[model samples]
Target: MYKVPKLNNQGTEGLEYLYIDSNGNIETSKDHSKLINDPDGVLGNTLKPLLKLPTSMPKDFGFITYNDQPPPDDKGVTPSVNSKFGHSKGLVMMDKTTGVWLLHSVPKFPFKRDNNFYPTSGAAKAQTFICVTFKYAEFQKIGQHLLDIAAFPFESHFPADFHDQLKKAAIIKWNNREPGEKIQDLESDAGTQFKSIAKKLYKGKMSACWLESEDLT
Candidate 1:
């Protein structure tokens, strides 16, 4: 996935997605342990993979991926903008110590649970992503922000005793009313401080703010 187009390597700018294992080693190839697969569903042949973690992963590890468009293999369609759902796409993976959140603008991506595949449609257009790593406690605030935005998480795994807000955010749900704006103060592992502003989607009114520099003392 890190390969660059030879012709446009000079000016092309894009984000690369990589999988890091428990030992802090980057996985260059497909790791079966990280794949989500379910051949059977609640009824039969549903192919809905549970959001549980692989046996090889630590029990505390958890992840959640959501998108406005469901995976094609699921036989689902995207909701209209008029609907209450949030037009957002992203994934959040975390453990007890720290975690990362990846926000992107790709449709029908991350492919099916059966494999690691990217959609041609997504590649045909320009896409952007922002990834950040944060301390575990910040995820609760992140979860609250997701809830406010009415995020639709398609797959996730939050262990027992996990934060209530995170578990709630990791599933499909609607907000009772327009949620209020929120501000979060975060500190990354590198000791960088950040302030973020988030609000729900209402009448196409969506806004976000963050500090992109490390010059703050």
Candidate 2:
């Protein structure tokens, strides 16, 4: 499994869950109930401001990522924008109506919402993540053309337009695609292949490193 790198805030380590109470006061607690469970703290304080960019899209977007696999298997390695944590991977989704881009990550916090102390063994993965947004159409073009990463687990896809020529091409491609059984055979190692391909993609102009800070707004 991937180990999310810890971050520091005002000298506090791994304090990303702190939230603001009413009256705009920063609040936290040692008992753990005070820990944040929603996305607002970061969104309201840090993100909303950067989203000032004008967008004609409906302002809708979301994220997609594969669930973690049980250990003792070759789980995939992802390159994180946070170099301190190395790299992480996830899917990117959009609402065509909205121009917002959501970075994806698996949310398996170390603590349960109700428990103040560590719980029993074999709980969810203790991973770290940052909640942020970006402008849509940031990437020049995206498609299955050579594993263009829209998300993991290979979710549903549809034709972006209803043009006759596009439809014909899609139908031909669909019929020519691998059979379902073939896809299942590859599923076991798909993530590993995805990671390898993503690395090679960075050599071209289609990729970005978190180190470079690809800002949309």
- The prediction achieving the highest TM-score against the true structure is 1
lDDT of candidate 2 over 1-217, digit per residue (tens): 1122343433323333433432456534333433222224332233232223223223343322222221121243331222111133333334443222223243322122122212232223333333322233331122232132212222222234422322222232343332111111111111211111322122335555555557866
TM-score of 1: 0.63
- List lDDT for all candidates, in order: 0.60, 0.28
Question: What digit string (tens of lDDT, one per residue) describes model 1 on residues 87-149?
Answer: 678877788888877676777755655433345455434555555778898888888877776
Model 1 clash pairs? none
Query: What are the runs in model 2 whose C-alpha is more than 4 Å off?
Result: 1-63, 67-88, 97-125, 139-151, 154-197, 201-217
